[model samples]
Target: MKLLLRRPQQSDIQALHQFFFHVIQDTYAKEGIAELVDDQQHEWELKKKYVAMDLESRGEKRFFWLAVDEESNKIIGTIECGEANEIIQQTIKEDLSYCPEIGTVFVHPDYQNRGIATLLVQKILTTLEKQKKSSFCLDSGYKQAQIIWQKKFGQPDFILEHFWGTNNHHMIWKRALPFQL
Candidate 1:
């Protein structure tokens, strides 16, 4: 499917929230496992909070990029970077060079394994480079995301095992800005 990487607008708010609640749930909440203490309600709130954060981040400062299906003209996925991740700052041992992190990334379940997420990520990465970000980081606990980052970005520098006091663990993957190379 053809995809267009576009900056989000207020018009996309409703659809974005719906996609986050349903499609994103399958990606984030694993069967019988979660740092949300396996609490469905907690996960619901957390997801809403992230969506709020995305909505609040429009035009400058934090950037949010969404991928739209050209044929369907619907938002299939989103990748966001912001300057407010205390966990990543602490985990990476230092704040990035004015660059914060890849915060919330989501793709619809039906769109999984379709290379859509990769395209979304690459689009955001390219946009971040143009914005002069010198470093990048993203957090992952779910198995699929952890694996994806490992393959796309190489090994993580930090892993907090049993981070949620179970099989759950926090993983942080980092990358330097291309201009820094």
Candidate 2:
């Protein structure tokens, strides 16, 4: 399917919110953390706010990139570059004083494993490079995402043992910018 990658628009807020809810719900269910489902709406609202802020600011501090299916005109994936979250900053011990993070990388479950995420990441990296960034950090706490990141980025620079729970950890990877996908 043809995909279009572009900055988020005002009209895409609801769609992005829905995507965030479902993806997070699915992740929680898959990880057997069904209790976290109750937190999905709160997280979605925060993400929606962030998206709205990004749209208004026009990448002044944070930028969001959305991948839309050209055939159906539906948002299929997204990625963003912004100041790193506190958890990530503390884990990586950098505080994002200078290094922004590439995050919020998500793809619809039906469209995953189809290179949508890879495309979104590549687009975000290109945008960061264009902004003169030389490197970025990526973090993940989900098992499935951790596997994919390990494959794509090799070993992480920081691994928080049991950060989420016993046997569930968070990892952070730092990559030099302007590199190929």
Choose the strongest candidate by lDDT: 2
User: What's the true lDDT of residue 111 in model 1?
Assistant: 80
> Model-by-model lDDT, in order?
0.73, 0.84
Per-residue lDDT of model 1, residues 27-119, tens digit only: 545544434445645655655566566667554555678889899998888877776466777776764757667866788777878987787
User: Quick one: best TM-score, which candidate?
Assistant: 2
Error of 1 at 144 (Å): 1.5
Please give the lDDT score at residue 52 for candidate 2.
78
Report residue 110 deviation for candidate 2 (angstroms). Answer: 0.9
Q: Which stretches of candidate 1 lie over 4 Å from their true place?
A: 28-31, 34-57, 179-181
Per-candidate RMSD vs. true structure?
A: 3.0, 1.4
Question: Candidate 1: minimum summed lDDT over ten consecutive residues — where?
Answer: 28-37
lDDT of prediction 1: 0.73
| Clashes (N, CA, C under 3 Å) per candidate | 0, 0
